[model samples]
Target: MSVTRITDVSEPLVAAFANLVPQLSSSATPPTRDEIADFLAQDGVYLFTYSNDDGAILGMLTLATFVIPTGKRAWIEDVVVDEAARGHGAGAALVEAACEYAHEIGAKTIDLTSRPSREAANRLYRRCGFVARETNVYRYGG
Candidate 1:
């Protein structure tokens, strides 16, 4: 599969949704088709697609930026590869692309969180040079 940044404004984001939804938390709300298109129209969010030679989108990743007093940071919010495409390097390619993009944007660090239940994903992150930080991530969201 080939890795590409999603840059075509006229392209349909729906093409990548099915591969993404299942990878999200079960209780999380899936974006409506319209929301996907609107999100793609914004800046500071990077979406990458892994497509086969036939142009079927097999995986996607969403990276968002945070600007705080410290500096800019990048967080990997979603990463999903079609079940049938797992053994291949689509996931890795997506992560690698994010790293390149993060560097391009002068981000101080790239962070991501995976559920404890997702052992394979944790392993992949570690293998990709991510250290298990000691800091705890807290949320006060409703």
Candidate 2:
């Protein structure tokens, strides 16, 4: 599998967005084409897609890096692999790519959160050298 940064809005990417949203969240709606274009245009946000030899997208993730008063940080978000593509390294590839990119950009640390119910995903993260932190994760709004 190969991972590539998505630089522009295209039909294939729009289709991939449609295919991935349901996998990422059952309650969240897929972003519109304009929203995707806007996202791609945002500074410090990197979107990557994992694909096979035939160039079919198997997974995607976004890495957003920004500088705060403390230091530069990177967050891996919206990670989703096609249901049929799970267990075949697409997820790992995406995470590795994101981590590498974050390092390249001088991020001090990369962070991500996974639900406890996602057993396999949690395990995958552990295998990729992610340690569970003893901290509270709070969300403000729906």
Candidate 3:
């Protein structure tokens, strides 16, 4: 598998994203083409896809890096691997690529959150060198 940054919002990309969002969350809606384009145009956001040799997308993740008062922070979000492609290392490849890219861009730290019910995903994150944080994660909106 190879991890590639998505620089454009094409039909295939949008379709794949639509298919993956429901897998990531039951209530979350897939982003529209304009939304994807807007996100791609953002200053410090990157969308990446993990694909097989045949050029089929197997997994995807987004990395958002920004400079806050403290320093630069990188956050990985919306990670999802196609259920059919789960055992072939697509998830790992995506995470590795995101982490490498974040580090290359001078991020002070990388952060991500996984639901406890996703046992396999939690294990994958741990294997990728992420430790469980003791801090509370509060969200203000959906």
- Order the candidates by lDDT, highest first: 2, 3, 1
Cα lDDT tens digits for candidate 2, 1-142: 7999899998888889999999899998999999999999999999999988988888999999999999999999999999999999999999999999999989999999999999999998999889999999999997
Ordered list by TM-score, greatest first: 2, 3, 1
Per-residue error for 104 in candidate 1, Å, reads 0.9
Cα lDDT tens digits for candidate 1, 65-112:
878999999999788888888868888888989988998989999999
C-alpha-based local distance difference test score of model 2: 0.94
Better of 1 and 2 by lDDT: 2
| TM-score, one value per model | 0.88, 0.97, 0.95
Per-candidate local distance difference test:
0.81, 0.94, 0.92
Q: Which ten contiguous residues of candidate 2 have the minimum total lDDT?
A: 50-59
Give the residue spans of candidate 3 off by over 4 A.
none
Between candidates 1 and 3, name the one with more favorable lDDT.
3
**RMSD for each model, in Å, please?**
1.9, 0.8, 1.1
How many clashes show up per model? 0, 0, 0
